[model samples]
Target: MKILLIDNASLTPVNSALCCEPKTGEFAKELQALGNEVTMYGQIVESENIHAFNIQENGINVVGHHRRKLKIFNYILLYLLIIPQIFKSDFIYIFYPSAFKYISILCFIFNKPYGLYVRGEMGLKNGVSSFIYKKAYKVFTVTDYFTTLINSLSKSNIAETIRPMINLNEKDIMPVNKKNISGIFKVLFLARLEEDKGVKEILYAIYKLKKMDYNLKLILVGDGGYKKEAMHIIDKLDISDFVELKGAIYDIDKVKNMYLDSNVYILPTYHEGFPRTLYEAMIFGTPIITTFVGGIPYLMRDKFNCVQIKVKSVESIVNALIYSINNHEKMLDYAKNAQTTVKPIINSTRLSHAEALHNAIHNI
Candidate 1:
């Protein structure tokens, strides 16, 4: 089978180099390994019109197309180049709906089947998403929570929840040692520093904790559109010393260390589509404190594996944190169970996701 994969979020000429969407690239490698000839089309760096390279080990050919920045001529040329590729390919796998827009028309004209993979919450009910999802042979989702929503928005019941590809190996896993619940509790908040990601809510929770004179350190990682505002909140509250805002660390080892050094991981995000960070925290045996949004509820239990908090609720965040601090032993239990629960999914590597894609194509 010849598969044409469109993942604009990934770096072009895909290799072992790390990028924002490494797992998506790894999945492409896995598809090639599954005996499918895959040509991954992604955005090219500036000044490069188009380039193609091969990952010899995986037998995957990666093509980098010029990234158009709101230019009509560029879009016209891109469509001309991509339509022929669609005619030649046996199947199409598009990561985001935006990318789907580029190929859906060609696929329709050629009478070819394509799979739509929804990575995030499609916030608005737009015609493009509705039409492509409805026309696609199948819709793959990251979480079960979005299954119903996608069906309603797309007006199609072809949506199925599939596991996300996370880069986790045995080396990244920390040694399971005896639980130590005492000392200055290290609470980690790692995600985009955005309003919807609950950065302000995290700050408010920390402020409430500080008022009670709780001995805890909050480490905020990742940079985004709300960094300055988040910084303002921290300074206004005069809790800068208690909180450390380490803007986006790109090193994978550094990220793993952050998880290892922290006693708990808190993601008070307002929305998510089965975030990979939860899997990372769980694999490292860090207890999770997150909101009941997106596919999070499907991945975890309210009080069993990890404590669930209410979305956009600072009081809920504070209460969950207090519960974690007061009942350290119980938190450790959650951490241990979380690691155990996530093992099967994370350890399987590309087999699970690849098989689902393969079956979706063959059945359709």
Candidate 2:
């Protein structure tokens, strides 16, 4: 089947000697592997003398449309252009509801089948997304909480919950060390350095732990708009000796190494649709310490696969960290359990995009 993927994100050429962002690139590759002719339509900010369209790595075709100067106007123009293309495709898989709603009118007009995939929390009080939720054919979300939110917001009662597919192979999962590593416990916080991502809370927790003489090393990965603010918090707390902000790591192998070296993965995010980092941490057999927010609790069970802390509380996070360090064996058990829980769900061979596309196509 021919599938036209409309992505608002940037897409460079395959021969550009640059790798695309892992998550988006993985999904694109998956669609291509499924024998579907995948055409990616993404943003092109500046004017290029050469052609815009290019075949990316793994044989995926990408078309870059120009959007100069005016940001809102470009998006509006893209939305208008996308409507005509939607009628030509066999299936329409949209990423967010706002864009989905904008495109849904065309699908509704033409009597076409379209699926909405919500990647983050959508049902905030008085948000514009509530209207978009009501128009989708089938709503797909990454977590149970998001599924619940979609169901509550949808007036038509057409929502199906499906977990985001992670492309995990044997290489992704590190061998579990049954023997515990001694000395300072390594903690990893892998996400965008944003206030909502709980970077400040993690730093404060680290400070509290250090004062109590808990040997810990914190590695902060991923760069975001909040880097300066987060750095200021790190400096203000004076826990620079224990915490190291390794900004924007894109290499998959290096990310896995960070996970392999760490004893615990802490993500005290205030909100999320479903965090991919949690799954990445679990795949590497690292015990997780995260807040009970969004889809986290759905993927993890307290005292079973991970330890859940209260959101925005330094005290809670620190206490949880101390508990995890002292009870290292239990943490390891949880890590092992996490590996068990996530392995089957994210395994690429068993359930590929080919299968998902087949399912979507057959249903349509």
Candidate 3:
């Protein structure tokens, strides 16, 4: 089967070749490994570095298209370029809502079947979203909460929960009961450093921790638009020694090491559908400090398996960190609960997700 995956993620092309984001890129490789001809279409850097239209990336074929400055013109050109791929692919799967708009029209014009994969609920509340999801061949959402939201908002029982396609070795996963809270008080923040993700709040929280003379260290393991600003604040706050901005880690082993070493994982994002990082932290038996937003509420209750902090609140983040530190036994218990919650889903291989894709396409 020739499967075409579309995403709004930017791909940098040059001597480094085509860059695919880890989650989507790894999932595409899984599809290809399943004997399916998989090709991904993503945004290419609009620069002189433009090379071939398609490149083989980690056993998967990646097709990148350069973007136009004008937003309207960009979509027009994007649709024109993607029309050919629409016909070429046996099944079309799109991640992200922006690329989802009007692709339905192109699919209908070609009489091709297309599935929708929504990672978040950002643009899910409007009429346009309702119509699009209602018309989709299948809708794969992240959590049970989001699944219900999609069906309710669309007024159609079309959305279903899809397992986050993460491959964690069961044997390597630290048993939650064996989790240790006493150690180097290190915090891990492993997501894009965006304002919405609460990077600034976290930085301030670290500063507050320092003011109290706590020898806590923070490791930020992702980069985004706010990286420069985050760095500026780190320098401004004079907490550089306490913070390490690792910047967009691709090495799973290195990432696993960070998770294992950290006493707690924090994601004080203002919004989310369900972050896959939460599950990663859970597998490592690291206590989680996050806001109760998106799919988080469905899986985690406050002071249950995770510490729920107010969104965008530096005070909440600081207090949560302090709470995790002072209450070792309780935090360990929470980590254990989190591990039990995510174990089944985390243990499932990416093959399960790929096979589900196959099943959805073939059955549809």
Number of the top-ranking candidate, with lDDT as the measure: 3
lDDT of 2: 0.72
**Per-candidate alpha-carbon RMSD to the true structure:** 5.1, 4.6, 3.1
Residue 330, model 3: lDDT of: 91
Q: Global lDDT of each model?
A: 0.75, 0.72, 0.80
lDDT tens digits by residue: candidate 1, 74-123: 66776677776787788988876454365876787789988877767644
TM-score (C-alpha) between model 1 and the true structure: 0.76
Ten contiguous residues minimizing lDDT sum, candidate 1: 46-55
* lDDT tens digits by residue: candidate 2, 154-234: 655566555456656545776653435577788899987778998888888889888988788999987766888888988
- Worst ten in a row by lDDT for model 3: 46-55
Superposed model 3: Cα runs more than 4 Å off = 46-55, 154-157, 177-184, 347-351
The TM-scores, one per candidate, come to 0.76, 0.80, 0.91
Question: Quick one: how many clashes does candidate 1 have?
Answer: 0
- Winner on lDDT between 1 and 2 is 1
Best prediction by TM-score: 3
Q: Which stretches of candidate 1 lie over 4 Å from their true place?
A: 8-20, 35-37, 42-84, 97-102, 123-131, 147-160, 169-181, 232-236, 247-254, 347-350, 358-364
Model 2, position 267, has a per-residue lDDT of: 92
